[model samples]
Each structure stands twice: as structure tokens, then as C-alpha cells.
Target: MWPFTKRPKDPVLDPSYGDPHRKALIRALEKRKWKFARELLNMAADPDEMAFLMEAVGGVDGIQDWIGDWMDAEPESTLPVLVAGCHAVRWAWEARGGKRAKYTTAAQFKGFHERLRHAEALLQRVLAREPDNVTARAWLVTSSRGLGVGPAEARQRFEAVTRLHPGHLVAHEQRLQYLCAKWSGSHEEMFDFARGAATAAGPNSLLHELVAVAHIEKWDATEREEGNEYIVSDEVRAELLTAAEDSIFHPDYVPAGPGWAPRVATFAMAFELADEFDAAGHAFALLDGLVTEWPWQILGDPVEKFTASRDWVTTNRS
Candidate 1:
């Protein structure tokens, strides 16, 4: 009677036609209309949409409310809602740009801060459910660092990640940077850890940089005759140069990976230290080419500029 003898299903009326009601609610929240969004969420037919909407607005509190209500109404199937809430919060954070703030307006910053709190709560929930979730643990570490949590807490999180997944390159790299910045140990101890991490992690460019820095620090500590520049001893400098050279062509030195630009930058530094103007010039040329070839991959353009300036100085001085 509605259309024909057997009525055809209306595609536009289907739940999957438009964006999921939950995603629409999230969009509305991002635009800062909490009241109307809540009303629309109340009218949402899908339980999953309602669960995601609750979590989107209320974070842990909303999740707990949904869990309580779901337990009373349908005890057999409440877990999915909890899980969906976790995923919703994770999606919200990731959609906002993965632990980094890219706020262009005051409204954007306010929204980001709210979403960050939600993300942290979701990660906490995930950890509670699966204490050994290495990915969640890594995200927690990154979130804490983003929120300006102390270095000790950050170190603990990074250590936990490496403990769970020893081969996590980003965690290892962060831990190395942390130790180098907070160097309180004897030079020998620092060098030992640096070398061990470099070996285990398979030729980290930061390791070479730290090793060169350690040599420079040692050079500073030693006796220097008046009017003589305090260059790292030739042996240590050569060792660092060789390490830098190896880093550039190492098995893991893919085009946009960790070892490319930093290795070239380190080589330029080493050449400048050895007073090899021509070699430094060649290294600088290589770096300049990288900037053009892989512009977005390069992390610190200022470092490249500094290296180029030094190469020019060395060339002109000769």
C-alpha cells in the first residue's frame, strides 16, 4: 500500500545512507552546539551511535553511564558500546591530528583541549582493559609529553614501551634523546649506553651525533694550549666520521627514514671539525639536494642552513 504490492526499501531512509549519526554528533560538537547535538543523540536509533555520542560529550563519565544503563537493559551486549566509545575517543583525537595541536582559532584550541582530555581518559580505559597494550602505552607516552607532563613520567612511559616492545624505534629514539639531554652520568657511562642503543637499534643517526658531542665534551675537558682551537682528537673525530658515513648507507636508511638527513648533517659537522672544506662542501651539496628532493621529510631546515653557511665559510677561508 505504501508504494507497490511489495514496497521497495528506501535507500535514503536506511541507517547507512548519510554519515553515521554518531559522526554527525561529533561534527556538531566540534562546531560547539552541545545542546542540539545532545537532542539529536537522544533521537539516534542505533545503540552504537548513542554510545559514541555519550562518550564524545562526557568522556569516562558518559562511558560509565552507558555501561550502567546497558547492563540493566541488555547485560549480554554492553561491552561493544564500551569498546565503541574507546574507539570514538581515539578517532576524535586522531582526527584532530594525533597528539599535536593545530589550532588556528581560540575556538579550535578550546575544542582541542577538550578532545585531549577525552583522549587521555580513553587511553586510561584501554590500559585498564589490557594493561600490556604496547600501542596504547606508546600513545599514552606521546599524550603525556604533549600535555607537558614531567620528564620522569615520560621516561617511565618510554621505558614501559621498550619493555613491552623492545624494537620500537620511536620509543628508543626518544629515550636516547632523553638520556642525552639529562646526562648526569660519567662520560664513559653515557658513551656505553649510547653505543649499546645504537647497536641495538641498528645505526641511529642521533647516536652518532651524541657520540660526536661526547668527544667534543671530552676535548673541552682536556688541556688546550693558548690560542689553539680545542678540536676533538683526530682518533675520536675519525671514529665519529666513520659512524656518520655508515649511517647514510645503512640498511635502514630509506629515503624519508630516521638516518638520512641527520647522517648527512653529522657528516657535514665532522668534515667541518676536520677542516676538510671540500668534503664539507660536498656534504652540504648532498644536504641541499635532500632538501629539494625530500623537502617535507627534512626535520630541521635551520640545521641545514647552518651547515650550508659553515661550508661557505670554510670554502671562502681556504
Candidate 2:
């Protein structure tokens, strides 16, 4: 049965789920107060926080149009340049639409490539001035795939960031997308990369969710019944349990900046699908009433699926 037939109050569907300061930055951008955005970016506590801030800025609609004002105002700062380049990548994908290649029109593909090229040029300029800009380097990793630079160049761009900050979550997540079977790699490659990264990352790191992400990708590709079977199988259940234990369940674990909510929500969904209601319930508990748009959006309405899953876990967990 479809779960969204009736609705309760909508869940908090915040994209910048874990970050309290994200709204102020977005408001500043909405008002074209670019200097305020620059101040927020400059004050970011670390690379992860900085990357998250840029990602939030990059996702705003029409940001590309007025971002140039910021670029003009701060000729010497790479901050606006990074924001422009990041938004260009997002805008390129918007041109491409969300459909597979077969469903996409040629003109859309042309616009996608053109925008990506513009993004690449801007990102390269930032790198030229600041070679150690791992945030710029990570966005470059994303654009490499869109530009069809192939696996070698993609890995090289990913390595450039990891060498500087080995645990850079955004960079690792982007590379994982590149490695997915739907993209450049096969299922074997995807799982291998996810498992290896999870193990290599330090204890309590959210990298363990990479394993859940891999399984979710595989689930998305398979037919419904078979996918359900695979996700609920004993092996998958055990692996997810192990991943939970190593990461979110670890006593030392603390949610990592803005990325934490989505990662937890991901594990919650995987657990519910795998029929490990207890684990799912715990994750939902961690989330309180908050929800993010992705992974659940893959199912249907993110809020509906999230609410249904959380409710189901509450009712069914032992």
C-alpha cells in the first residue's frame, strides 16, 4: 500500500538540516547582501563547515545571476568565485534535468555541458590563485564527472582534496557518486569503494554511512521484490548493524556539522527497509522531528516516507 494517502502535519524539511546559521546566510544572499555571506564564509570554523556553507549558497535558485555583483565587489577574494563556480555546477545539472540520458533532450545536454564548462573555468581560476582550496577542489571532483573527464582524472581531482583533508565528507560523498554503477563504475566498484572508505576512516566518523549508501544505490537499481529481498537479507542486515555500531551508535560519535542529519536519516531509511525496526527507531529518535529531502525523496514524499517509517518503527520495534 502507498503510504502517503493521508497526511499529518508536515515534518521540518530543512535542506540545511543541522546548521543553525544557514538561514542567516541564505537570507543575506536572497537580499543580495553578498558581504554578509562573505563574512559567514570567512568565519567558518573549519573546512567541513566552509564546504557546507558554500553548498548551501550554491543551491539557491538564480544565485548565478546576482553572484557576479559579489565577484565585482571583492575582486581579490576567492570566496565569491567559489560560490559562483559551485552554483554554476548546480545550474548545469538543473539544465540537464533529473532524467536519465535517454529521457533528456539534446539541447538540454548542450546547455548542461556549456554551464559545466563555465563552472570548470571558474573553479580552475580559484585553484590557480589558491591551490590548497579543498572546497574548490571537491566541487571540481563533481564537475569532472559531469564533464566526462573519465575515471583517472576524476580520481585525481578527488585525491587532490583527500591528500589535504583525508576525512573531507563532501569530497568523499561526491567521489562515491562518481563511483556508482549508474555513473562511471559498476556495483562491485561502488561497494568496494564504500566498504574500504568506511573501514579506513576513523572510528565514529560518518563514513560508515557510505556502506548504507552503497546498499541503497543497489536497492534503487534492482526490481522491487528482489530489491526488498536483498535489503532485508541477513547479510545486509548484519552489515548495516555493524555500520551503525561503528558510526552513529559509537559512544564517541558526534554529529558532523550540517551533514549529520541526512546521514542519520539515510541509515534510518535503510534500517526500516531492512526490517530492523529497533535500529530505525533509534535513528529517528536522534532526528527528533527534523528531516532532510534526499534518500527519502527517492521513495516518494520525503516527509511522508520519513513519518511513515518513523511511525512504523515506533509501533513495531521490540
Best by lDDT: 2
What TM-score does model 1 achieve against the real structure?
0.43
Query: Residues 35-86, candidate 2, lDDT per residue (tens digit)?
Result: 7878887888888888778778876888888888888888998888989998
Which run of 10 residues does model 2 get worst, by summed lDDT? Answer: 1-10
Record all residue pairs in model 1 with backbone atoms less than 3 Å apart, i.e. clashing: none
- Misplaced by over 4 Å in model 1 are 1-156, 163-167, 181-189, 202-231, 249-254, 270-282, 289-304, 307-310, 313-318
lDDT of 1 at 193: 55
Task: Please give the lDDT score at residue 41 for candidate 1.
Answer: 58
Query: What is the C-alpha local distance difference test score of each model?
Result: 0.48, 0.86
lDDT tens digits by residue: candidate 1, 198-247: 66655634445555444444443445552115454556556666665555
Model 1: number of backbone collisions: 0
